[model samples]
Structures are given as C-alpha cells and as structure tokens.
Target: MTNSPKLAVRGLTKRFNDLEALSHIDTEIAAGEFISIVGPSGCGKTTFLRIVAGLEQASSGEIRLDGRPITKPGSDRGFVFQQDNLLPWRTILANAMIGPEIGGFGDKARVQATRQLLKLVGLEGFENYYPKQLSGGMRQRVNLARALAVDPEILLMDEPFSALDAQTREIMQTELMRIWEEGRKTVLFVTHQIDEAVYLSDRVFVFARRPGRLQEVIEINLPRPRSLAIKRTPEFVALVERIWNLIEYEVRQSVLEEMS
Candidate 1:
C-alpha cells in the first residue's frame, strides 16, 4: 500500500427526499486493496456504492480518487452491477469492448486488449456468443471483462455475484480472486453475504442499519492466494462468524426499531 490512499470517502451522506439512506460514511482505501461493505437490508450499502460510481448523488460530503474529488463517473472507476446488463444482441467480444467504444478509443490496440481481458476473465472461446447463449456465470464473466476493458484505476462492484446460483457464485468468487490477484486493482465490493465478504475482502466494512453508518472495519488476517478451501479453515470461519454476528446484531436492532 502507498502512503496515500487510493480512494477516500469523507463525511458522506445521502438522502431520498424524506428518507436518509446513508449517514456520515468515512473511510480510506489504499491502492490494490480489496474492500467489502456489508450491512443489513436497506442499510444503503448499494446506495453508497452507486454514489461512489457517480450513478447517484450524495446529499453531502464527497468521494475522492487519487486526491481528486469524484463528482461524476469517469473511466478511472469501473462498475459491475448486480445484473450483467449485457446487450443481448451484442456478441461477448463486442460487449466487452463497450467501454473502449464509448470512450472513442476503440482502435486495434484496444481490440487486442479486450480480447486479452476476455481471456483473463475465462471467456476466450466464448467471445462470439450472445448474452442469451451463455450461462449466468459466463454472462457475468463478460460483465467483468467489459468493466476491465477500460482498465479503470478502481473497480466498484455492487453484489456482482448475488444473482448467480450458490455454486456459480462460489466459482465466480474464486475467479474474481484470481483476476484481482493478477491486477491488484483497488476494489470496493458491496454484498449482503457475510461469507462472501469475508472470503474476498482485505478488510470488511460493517455498516449499521439505515440510515447506514460505518460500524467497524475488520481486517482479514489470513494470507493471500486464498482458495475455497480457506473458507473451511478455522481462521476463515472465525472471520465470517465475526462479521455475521455484527450484521445479525444490526438486523435485530433494525427489526426492534421498526416494531417500536
């Protein structure tokens, strides 16, 4: 990690008219770090991510990348939504090239790079396939390749695996780890799955119920090059349990508040 943070969130807050979605979110993400945000439902986890992606506006405060204020979305940040959002008519290669195309830099070099990224994401042979022709997992792989096509500085993923089946989700988690290890891009992933968060994160940012606040940031002490087997280890299980306990408590508190 560098002496300076890769991304910084300061006093961030968001509101939807009468409802406040996020409250006073503050944190720093170092370069090449993988961070996960987890919290109870409606805790503004996705809202926070969208704000950082410049898809949603924050009611107050700011997000900075490399010391520059991030008031709008730019190529510096790549986002993977819960849904793959691939154009059904477009081939996988074409979909992956969407970023470069939109940026008006879709030259032969960009095409070669996109092909490389497609292979990196394990979609080399499927480049000609349409979205409907691929499996859910494969489609998501295309989504990832599309995001990486732009070579963004930071990757913002909002439950990118949440739509997949349990088995496919696990597979994608391992795939994501492999891709992340290769590039070590600064990533901010949001998920409701505690185990997923534990497995993929360098640190897990636990949030309180809505209006969400940063409750704690727990560092994962396990060694890297993590595999699915690590999820079975005592150390990994303990981390998952710890995060689960925190989120469970928040969920209970939210329920009690609603009941009251």
Candidate 2:
C-alpha cells in the first residue's frame, strides 16, 4: 500500500466502434478509500470499472497503480462482478481459495486465509457447501471471499448485490462495510442504487449517459459504522436527494438523445 492512490484513472476513455462507453474519465481511488460510482443504465459506469480492471481496453488515456502504468490484469486488483459467478462443483471454501491457488500460494496458508475471509463475511459454518446449496446472498458472500483470497490492493465491484432481495441486499451492504473497514482496502464500486452508493462510499461519482461523462462528485459526510439507522437520518436523505436531482436531468437527457 502506497501513500498515494492505489488506483488512478487519467482521462480514461473507452469506445466500442462508434459507441463511446466512457469519455475523459478521471478519478483517483486512494489507498483504503471506498469509492462508489453511481449512474443510470448505459451511463458507462460498468465500462469505466472494466477498463480499470483491464478487462476492456480504453480508446485513449491511461491508468496507473502507484504511478506505474496498468496495461494488463494481475492480482493488484480484484473484481467481483454483478453475478456471484461461483463454481457449482466446488465447495464454498474451495471457491474462495481459487485465487490463492492460481497465484501459487501454499495450501495451508490459502485455506487459512480463505477461512478467515469467509468468516468475516459471515459464512464460517457453510464453507463445505456448494454454490447450489447456498442462497443468492450466501453465494455472493463466497464471491466476496474469493476476491479477497489473493489479498489484492484494490477491489473493483460491479453491483454485486443488485440481484438479491431487499433484505439480503441490506445485509450484504452492512457486511461489505464491515469487511472494508476491517481491512481498509481500496474499493471502486459501481451501482445504479442511489442509496447504496451513498451509504457505502466515502465519495460518490455520478456519471452522465451515452458517452459517460463525469457529472458531479458527492462527498459522503456520514460517520463510520453506518447502519440502517443512518439511512433514515435527515443527512442521509438530503444526500440521496441531492444525488438524485443531479442525475435525473442527465438521465432524461440521455433518454431524449436516444429517442431523437
């Protein structure tokens, strides 16, 4: 962990043929900072994160990790996709150990690390269960554990809780906050949920549609260990309202442009 940003994006742009997914994206995710990107569908939030993870090539611009150019995928960044994407054949513990195994860690150390992560995510007793044996939320917990197995310096998540029930999503959000605070890991999260973004992020980046330009950045002044009670606070509501007002206009503009 460097004193500077663990991940930095400078004028990052991504285009697919004539469709520009991200344009001039500039953001810095400092070490141990929890940053969330919120935008409407097709706003290119996903594309932006994918570029950072080196899953998609950007048309121009550059990404750096601790001042070093990021040109390909490696263990420096861990990604948890929208779907849990667990392996059905493997047990939860086995799935969680995959990253460490692939990275050539010793068996005992990987098992110990995976067990600790699973415990942190509240799946301690279910380590032997397969993916199909677990619920959506449980599978997601496994997904999170797997990502942390290699101890990556950064975590890039793309709406990893969007598919769960409201209750499950709430639980997972709290769990995510716990995991983040415990490890102080740098995170770049993407989601369409305004409340989710506001609750989880130290700073929230809003994106405009079509080409996905930076709209506004909101600082979450809420205190740490934010529980559901904080979400009901006047301060939380105010933040959510402000973010919605900023993005609503952009979303309408995007819709109109598509129609036109």
Candidate 3:
C-alpha cells in the first residue's frame, strides 16, 4: 500500500539437501502489476511463489512486501492453488465467507461482502450450491471469489486453471483479467502455459531449469483490456514462440540428464 513496489525478491534461493530448487531469484513487482513465472517442470516456479506466499522458506535472500520482510503468511496476500480446494461440505457462500468469518468480521458484514464477491465472480445465485454441484469452471470461480473475499493487496496464484478443459481455461483467463482490471490487485501468477502467460502478464519471467534462476524477463506490449482475439496476432505468436524455445531446450536437457 505504500509507495514501495508491491513485492520484491532479492537473492532468493531454496534447497532440499544438495538439490537447489531456486537460486538467486530477484525481481521487483510494481503495485497492481500482473506478472507470470514460466519454466519447465522442477525449475522452482512454484517454489518461488510459495516463498513469496510465506508457505515456504528460502535457503537464502529475502522477500519484502511494501519494504517489510515477509516471514509468514498473512491476510495481505491470498493464494489460489491448482486445485480449487473448496470445502465440499460447505455451500459456496459459506466457503467464500470463511476467511472473513475467521477474521472475526460480524455475520452481516461477512454475508454482504461474500455476496458482492460471488456477484463479481458471476456466482451470485449459486451461493447455496455445494462444490460438488457446480461444474469445474464454476467451482474455480468460487475459489477465486474466496481469495478475493479477503481483499488481499496481492494475489499469488499457482496454475489455478491447469485442471480445467481448454475452453474453460480460456474463459477463466478472460474472467480473471476482468476481475484483475476491476480490482487492480497486484498479481504474481505461476504457470507452464506460455500462451496463457503471454496473454495475461504485463511481464513474463522465463526461468532456467532446476535451481531455478530467472533467465529472462520479457515485456508483453500487447494492448490492455485484452481478450482472446489478441492471442492470434503475429506479435503474440512471436512472443509465445520465443518463450517456448527457451523452455523446450531446458525440458530436453532435463530429460537427458535424468535418462543419463
């Protein structure tokens, strides 16, 4: 909320015994910026995201939110995982209201806030429906609404749409862009999908394989308020191809090392 960048990571490294998952990762994310991290599997994209979310610790270096060191998870940052992870027993409204309820907000206020969020996410009338009752895309919408219910200053997402069908994934992407634009929340998204990364991020952080180091930061110069139409443009295809080449090489190298 201060004038400082919404998030900053410096020399962040993570290790499991001798296996380095991430190394010397550094980046600064401006307030309200949308950034995506992409790389081959095991490159530590999720590890870096988890460290920023305070779900995990780094072997070395630091992460700061508004210039303050991030030591553990807080309400200031919300996370949506690959799975919706909604409580199946709880109705959609109850699920979305959980965070506010835990925060000790009064019932009326929580209900009001949850309703608005459901509406924002296009899940208004479905509030009483259970997670099992909704389609995959609809349930993910609940997941998103719940994350937004907390009104976190930053949203850290790890492949939130990976499980959905291709068509659903595209729809969700469009919905997310609209929600992001409306809320202006700072977002750090992690995914292996190059096209999705190019379409959604203001900048894409291309990472090297294991012991993930940021290999490149490519700016997405496409016009804002974008939709699927932009993905077909020559510029979009070129950027996607550029990133794919980097990742494809790493993926092959990783496979060969494992086989050897």
Candidate 4:
C-alpha cells in the first residue's frame, strides 16, 4: 500500500528567461485538507497554482496525484480564479452548466448537478442573473458553484475573495469554510492575507519572492467548524503572530530587492 499525498509537488521550478518565478518548491497537500498558500505580491504563489491546475506549464517539476504524475488539465482538479471569469453574456445557470459540458457529463445529469451546486453556493434564485448584474461576492459564489458542478476531488483557488469588501470577505470566508465542511473537497488556496490564511486554513504555506520557496508551514491549531468568533481568541492571535514573525524577514528582503 502506497501512502502518498493527494497532490505532491517536488523540486518545482519555473523561470521566465532571467526571471525565476518559483524555485525548488516542494509541497504536499493530502486528501480532504484545506491548505492556504500565502505570500507577498510577486512571490509566484499564483504561478504555482496555475502550474498545478495545468493552466501554465512549469519550467521543471514533478506533480503527482495519488502517486501518479499530473501532466494536463483534468476534472479531478477544479480551479477557481481570482476573477469570476463568468461569460459576460451567459446567465448564472448557463455559466454553471458549462462545467459539466466540458467535463463530459450528459445534459440531464449536468442540469441536476448545476442546480444542486447553485443552491449549495447560495445562488439559487440568481440562476438567471448575468455577471454584469451581480456583486463581486455574488459573482465569486457563482465561480465557486461552477467549479463544484463537476464534483472535483481537489479545488485549486487563487485569491478568490480578495476583491470583496471587509464585511463581504469575512462572510465569504465563513461560506468557504461551510462549503469545505459540507462538501469535503481537498483545497489549495492562494492568498496574500495572513489573517485570512490563518482563519481558513488547516495549514498555511508562506513563500518568499524572486524564486519563490516555502519559507514556513504553520499548522493551524484552532478547532474545526471555525467561526468568525475564533478570530478573537488568544490562541488564534498567538498562532498568527508566530506565522507573521516567520515571514517578516523574507517579506522585507523581497521589498529591499525591488528597491535596489
């Protein structure tokens, strides 16, 4: 019996000519885990996520799922981009339906699945709404629903809530936790907010800029079914402080490099 992470990335490196986006980065996300990748801007966190989603090819790396290599986009790995990226002309239901169509599920099954997903994401009555007609958070909810329609084993998200207001971001965080708890999907989320990372993650991976590498991996010791109220606890603050201190030096170095 082989015990392998659901997603394993080894010696991952990406270079754009003289620019190194990621380097010697290694990470393993187990099945059913919610892991957050956080770092300053330009740290290659999004690039790493794109590589795993097969949206972009890595310069060099080994990506594995259940111990098998991952070389292309597949339904098993679902992706939610920062922008909703909904079809400007399509209704919310139409947007959600497209997932199943591309994923190879037939119409009836796709329709049923999309409806259930719309409900799950709290957009039940907005099925007819278009992206132009929705708020940022609402659009992100549809973005999430579309990703879920295919029932992916692992979700790859890149700062899906960064655009919303403080209140909306908090609500979305709660919603995201609810989805993770109820749906039991493995997730690898990328974000720049340390608090957001600590609040929503099982483990938080902090990266360094300019040839990004994992600087630290902090395990969140907070209780499950985490609520907004958890943010006020002393334990949460202590963990956040510990994580912040670990990344502060790297972040300062990144800024200094840019200044020079």
Candidate 5:
C-alpha cells in the first residue's frame, strides 16, 4: 500500500438541527484498502458514509478524495444502499448501466462493461430480467454491479447485505470477498454486524453511540484469500469476540443513558 491516503476524513461532524450525529472524526484510508464501520444504531455510521459519498453534507469538517474536498456526488465514488433500490422498469443489464448512462458514457463500451459487471456479480445470463423477477440476494448483486459499472475509485456501501436471509447473506459475503480481491477497490462499508465487519475488512472502525465518535480502530491480521471455514478458527473467533465486546459495551451504555 502507498503511504498516501486514497481517502481522508478530517475533523468530520454532522448535525441535524439540534441533533448532532457525528463529531470530529478523522481517518486516512490507503489505496486498495477495505475498511468497515460498526456501531450501535444511530451512531451516525450511515451518516458518515453518506457524507463521504456526497449524498449528505457534513455540518463541519472535511472529507477529501486524493486531497480534493468532496462537495457533491461524483462518478469517482459509488454508493450501494442497504436496500437494492434497483429500478423495476429496467432490465438487470439496463439497471447496471444506470451509472454509466448518468455519466454520459451510455455507449457500446459501457454496455459491454455493464455486462461484464453483471457477470462478475454472478448474474451473467439474467441480464434480461427485471428487478421484481429476482430474489433479494440477486437484486443486491445487481445493486453491486450497478455501483461498479461506474468504475469508481472508491465504493461506499451501507449495510448492503443486512436485508438478506442468513444463508444468502453468508453466500453474498463470500462473493463480495472474491470480487473485492479481484478488483481491490478501496471500500468503506457500514454494517451493524460485528462478524461481518471482522470477516470482510482490513481494518474495522468502531464508533461510540449517538453524537458518534471514533472509539477504536481494530486491525485484522488474519490471512486473506479467506474462506468461510476460517470463521470457525480460533483466531477469527477471537477477533469477532473482541469487536463484539467493544460494541456490546457501547450498546449497554446507550441503553443506560436512555434508561437514566
């Protein structure tokens, strides 16, 4: 990895009227690194992600990509929502082409690229199908393909697999790791699942409860080309336990504060 950061967040904060969501967050993400953010609900995990994606504005602080301040949505960043959010009227291939279409690259090359992306997400022959025709897992794969069709430098994913059933979610996680390993795109994923965070990330950033602040950044030293079998190993279990402990403490504190 290069010493320079592909993405930089400095003193980032967000507020909604009287409610402060995020506070004074700072981090540097190196090129090709996969980072995941985890915290209790309403800890501004999604807020921080939206700020980075330029979908939402930060009340204070700055987020830069390659040192340029991000003011609004751009093709350089791709966002995948918790919901698939695919267009019902469009076929799978056409939906994947949305980004390239919006960017004015709706030519044969982009269409070809979109097809490749669909294939990459393991949806090669399903191009003619509509969003309603596919299962939840397949739709999410389309969502991922759409994001990658833009060929963005960074991918901002907010709980992309949280909606799936347990079996499908695990399958998608393995698929994601494979795709990420092949592409090595810099990714910032937000999830409430501690095990998911530990399993997929190079580093996991944990946040405190509302008025979210960075509480800890845990580095995962586990070997990569990681298989689902690794999740059963002592080392993987230990890492998951460690992260769960941090989050469990924050959850308890948040509950206590509410009770008080």
Candidate 6:
C-alpha cells in the first residue's frame, strides 16, 4: 500500500426526504485492497457503494477516487450488482465484451480481452452459452467477468453471490479470491454474510442499522491466499463471533423498529 488510499470516503451520508439512509460514514481503501461492508438490511451498504460508483449522489459527504472527486459514473469504477443482470439474448462472450465495445476499444482487442476475462473467471468454454443455460454460480461468474472486462481501477460488488445455493456460493467465493489475487484491483464488497465478509476481506467494516453508521472496521490478521479451511480455525471462528456480537444488537433494533 502507498501513503495515499486509492479511494477515500469522508463524512458520507445519504437521505431520501424523510428517511436518512446513511450517516457520517468515513473510510479509506488502499490500492489493491479487498474490503467488505456488512450490516443489516437498509443500512445503506448499497447506498454507500452507489455513491462511490457515482450512481447516486450523497446528501452530504465526499467520495474521492485517486484524489479526484467522484460525481458521476465512469468507466474507472466497475459495479457488479446482486443479480447477474445479463441480457437474455446475449451470449456469455458477447455480454463480457459489452463494456470494452461501448468504450470504443478496438474490435479485435475487445474480443481478446473478453476471452481472457472469461478464462480468468473459469468460464472459458462456456463463452457461447446463454444466461438461461447457466447455473446461478455460472451466471454470477459471467457477471464478474463482464465487470472485469472494463478494466476498472476499482471493483464494487454488492452481494454478487447472494442468490446461489450454499455449495455454489462457497465455490464462487473461492473463485473470487483467486481472481482478486490475480487481478489486484481495489475492491469494496458489500454483503450480509458474516462468514463471507470475514473470509474474503483484508478488513471488515461493520455497519449499524437504518441511517447506517460505521460501527467498526476490523482488520483481518489472517493469512492471505486463504482457503475455506481457515473458517474452521479457532482464530477465524473467534473473529466471526466478535463481529456477530457487534452486529447482533443492530439487527434486533432494526427488527423492533420494523415491527413497531
């Protein structure tokens, strides 16, 4: 990491008229770092991400990328949403090529880049397959490849694997770590899974409920190039338990508020 963070989010807040979606979030992401944001539903994890991606304006706050303020969506940031969001008619290869093609990259280069990305995401031979033909995990892999095709400096993924079954989700998580290690793009991932956050992050940001606040930013001391086995280790379990305790109260509070 360098002296400056790759992304800086300062005093970030968001509102929708009567409801404050987020409040006073402050965080910095080092270049090539992988960080996860975990919190209860409606805590603005996605909203925070949108601001960084320049999709939504922050009511009050600043988001800077490489020391430049972010005001609108740009090719510099690649966003992978909860769903694959792939076009039903496009082939996997075609879908992955969308970004580069739209950016006016050369046809041959775009094709080459898309193929390489598909291979990197373990979807090499499936390039010709349609979205409907793929399993949930495979479609998400396509989503990732498409996001990476843009060659963004930063990748923001919002629960990209949330729709997969347990087994497939685990597999995709491993694939993601491998891809991240290979690509080395700065990543800000938002998810609700405690174990998922802990397993994949260099640091985990815990957020409180609605009108979200940054509750804690815990650095993961675990070794890198991590394997799923680490989740069973005493150290990993302890870390998960610690985060669970931190978020559990917020979860209950949100539930009570909803009920009332």
What TM-score fits each model? 0.95, 0.94, 0.95, 0.94, 0.96, 0.96
The CA lDDT of each predicted structure is 0.90, 0.88, 0.90, 0.87, 0.92, 0.90
> Which digits, one per residue and each the tens of the lDDT, describe model 1 over residues 156-230?
999899999999999999999999999999999999798899999899999886577899999997888887999
Instruction: List the candidates ranked by TM-score, beginning with the highest.
Output: 6, 5, 3, 1, 2, 4
TM-score of 4: 0.94
User: What lDDT does model 6 reach?
Assistant: 0.90
List the candidate 2 regions with Cα displacement exceeding 4 Å: 1-3, 252-260
Error of 6 at 53 (Å): 0.8
User: Number of backbone collisions per candidate, in order?
Assistant: 0, 0, 0, 0, 0, 0
lDDT of 4 by residue, 4-63 (tens): 789888899899888998988887888888999988778898888888887788888878
The best candidate by lDDT is 5
What TM-score number comes out for model 3? 0.95
- Model 2's alpha-carbon lDDT is 0.88
lDDT of 1 at 213: 88
Query: Model 2, 117-204: lDDT tens per residue?
Result: 9999999899898899899999998999899988999999999999999999999999999899899998999987999999999999
Candidate 5 lDDT at 87 equals 84
Clash pairs of candidate 4? none
| TM-score attained by model 1 | 0.95
TM-score-wise, the better of 2 and 6 is 6
> Residue 196 of candidate 3: its Cα lDDT?
99
Can you write out model 6's per-residue Cα lDDT over 1-260, one digit (the tens) per residue? 44798998899889899788889888888999999999888788998889999999999989899999999998899999998899999999998888887788748877988899999988989999999999989999999998888899999999998989999999999999999999899999998899999999999999886567898999999998899999999999999999999999888888888899
In candidate 4, position 24 carries an lDDT of 89
